[model samples]
Target: MNRRHLLTITAAALAAPRLCFAQDAWPSRPVTLLVPFAAGGSNDVVARFMAPVLEQKFGQSFIIDNRPGGGGSLGMGMVVRARPDAQTLLVSSASNHVFHPLVSGDVGYDVREVLVGVSMLTDVPTVLAANPGIGVNTVPELIAKIRATRGGFAFGSSGAGTSNHLAGELFRMRMDLDMTHVPYRGGGPALTDLVAGTIPIAFMNLPTVAPAAEDGRLKIIGVCTGERVSVRPNLPTVMEQGVPDFAVRSWTGLFAPRGTPQAIVDRLGTAVREALAAPPLVARLTALAAEPIVMTPAQTDAFVRQEYERWGPVVRSANISANG
Candidate 1:
């Protein structure tokens, strides 16, 4: 071969190794798992639990940063605008990723377009609960009481566009009940009000309200999952209580920017699955009433898309908006 051709070939061969090295050296620094909601929420708790495991697996720190505002749009926008180097990832849930976008006008970035799912961490079933004063022990009783009250009944939820809120809307739509929604800042406030009988009933995360139910402060009418959950197998599902196709779960997942490398995404997904399978992590998640749902990157993407499609009609039919 000609001298120029030989030199060109040699240079190409030399550069290929460097390119692979750079690609393999992902996370090169401490990674940030940005949670769009306030701390102590399900998303934050899951992130904190997985951070150490990810750190050990990657040999890099995985720090969780909470930026709560605009119903999670603020932090979501930040992550959407971040570089797709796997250094800054998003730890989000169905509330922000699916429900909020469906009900809000402009969330700055479309989740489907700007973010890609890496892994689905866990699924927490929602519970339809009532204050003791409501004197309703089951879904049928609650339905009867709602029908009896000519003034109509009101139900509480974590926030206007949250998953629990949508679940309430779904319940209202399915049962053809004349119910109004009472949105609180978060589940904690909503639970406090439910326990105080400020609201007759509320749909909340099972984990958040399990304590109250156990203490007799509140009555869990039924879980919103399609089937009974392992955490509370004795508690029947809304569907079993005569509400057909009534299943709503609050799920947390890991996501990266759209342009993030597939290899890194797959690596992260595998790491998450492994961490979730660990006995200690499984026990902790079970204790919190959260079921670990480990999914591959492709499965996670499909699940998010399915959720987005499933909740869109509910939001539109219920006429739910970000304002209320």
Candidate 2:
């Protein structure tokens, strides 16, 4: 080959890396994080608090685009179809991403195609609470009663394909009982109905149930985790209550469209971890009624994939769907 041609190829190869590095040093413009749920909710608050910190660190505005509809699917679909640019991202929850996939298969994006970035959030446990007037102070007792009755009892969830719904299903399957499933359109409605005695037992998320548990309006039977949470240490876990296999927790994480440069992924992952580790940041998240956790890009990908596989079959077997 001629010297001129060889030099040209060498320069091209070197320039390719520089181009990639340029992409890696992203957030040159404003970064948009799409929160699928509406504003003023739990997820919204977390996003609102973290946006300023991220903007300060990266020197780029982090804006939240609220697109609430279809049980958090509308916004997710928009982001999934967007360019695989590091600028467009999503803050998604387990139930919306995992359970929704099971119930609504037509969602525009495939779990395998979306790139999980980093997890900056986790929802506290929804205690296995029951009204004492129902004669069940613990999960086992509730299970025993439902079993003895041959699944005559009814339990409510936030909505179809929601985390609250899956929690009850997981418990029923674990205890080897046949409990009827009743779902409401949203958590607020479900909780109201539960307190009014329309549904004797239900599994709502932590902050929502905590007030009732403390006021003697509800009896917490167990937590749906591997270990008891420090927030409510006295309560036992489902595993601790003898259903060794029962475990479920609603969580959220940041994600980018697929094919984003790896360097951006690494940088964003580190930023999320550092943000969560900051004491003041953690304090703000706690005050917002959520937990801020950071997982590396690879770790987030593995966790999301595992959950999708695990719940895909569970939802199919239980015949849980978004359709009423």
Candidate 3:
């Protein structure tokens, strides 16, 4: 080869690694973190609260898209379709994965197909309550009533397939009883109806339901966790009473399209993990009675898949459906 050609070829080889490194760095631009819930809700609030820190660390804006309907299925649908370029992330939690497919079969995306990006957040524990007049004072009492009534009691939840709905369903499964579930657009309406006795009982987020339990609108029977939440130390856990190894946790996390590079997922996960460990964020989450959950992308993925499989039988045995 001519000297000029050889020199040009040598230069090209040297520059390729730098170019590849830049391309694989992931997150070349601002990332959109989709929150499949209303603005100012727990998930959205947490997303916005941490967006600034992520932007500072990643050198890109972390925008939020609030798509509230079908619980969290709609926003997750959008995330599943987006390119796996680390530019998009879904702020998913337990509700989105556990209840959507169980209640309705046509969510249009196999959760397995969409790769888990990061677990941006999670709640401390789930909560189940009765609006009173159910004549149940504790978890066992409620279970006995359901057993006697043959699961005929009415219950309200955020939506057909939400973490809230799954929490209630799983609780029923453990007790071996059945109940009618009333799905609402969101927790706000569900809580209103529960207090009005339109629905006798329900499973809801702790943050949303704790106030009612305090104000006497709804009676706090038990927390759907293995241990009592420190924020409400007076509350007892369902497991502490009778059932063993029964814990239903509702959490919010982030997801991305499949095949998104590990580097990007790791980057986002690392940022979130670090942000969660921050004292200021920790204090804020504690005050809100929301625990900051940080997990590796793999850990988050496994947790979601387990919930999906675990809730399948409970949904089937209950015969709960979208139409119901």
- Per-candidate Cα lDDT values, in order, are 0.86, 0.74, 0.76
Poorly placed runs, candidate 1 (over 4 Å): 1-19, 147-152, 195-198
The window of 10 residues in a row where model 3 has the poorest summed lDDT is 115-124
TM-score of each: 0.84, 0.74, 0.77
Candidate 2: residue 59 Cα off by (Å): 3.6
Q: lDDT tens digits, residues 181-300, model 1?
A: 888755667888899999999998887787788889999999999889988899999999999878888888999999987888888889999999999999988887889998999999
Q: How many residue pairs clash (N, CA or C atoms closer than 3 angstroms) in each of the candidate models, in the order given? A: 0, 0, 6
TM-score ranking, best first: 1, 3, 2
Query: What lDDT tens digits, residue by residue, belong to model 3 across residues 1-324?
Result: 999999999999999887668656666778898887766456766678778888888787889888878877887788888888878788776677667776787787678765664764756467788888677789888887877875377778777777677677666666666777788766667778888888888887776666677788898788887788887788898888786667777777777789876776777788889989999888877766788878888888887777778878766776666644
Query: How many steric clashes does model 3 contain?
Result: 6
Off by over 4 Å in 2: 1-30, 38-42, 68-71, 103-108, 130-137, 140-154, 173-200, 211-219, 238-244, 284-292, 316-319, 322-324
- Candidate 1 local distance difference test against the native: 0.86
Candidate maximizing TM-score: 1
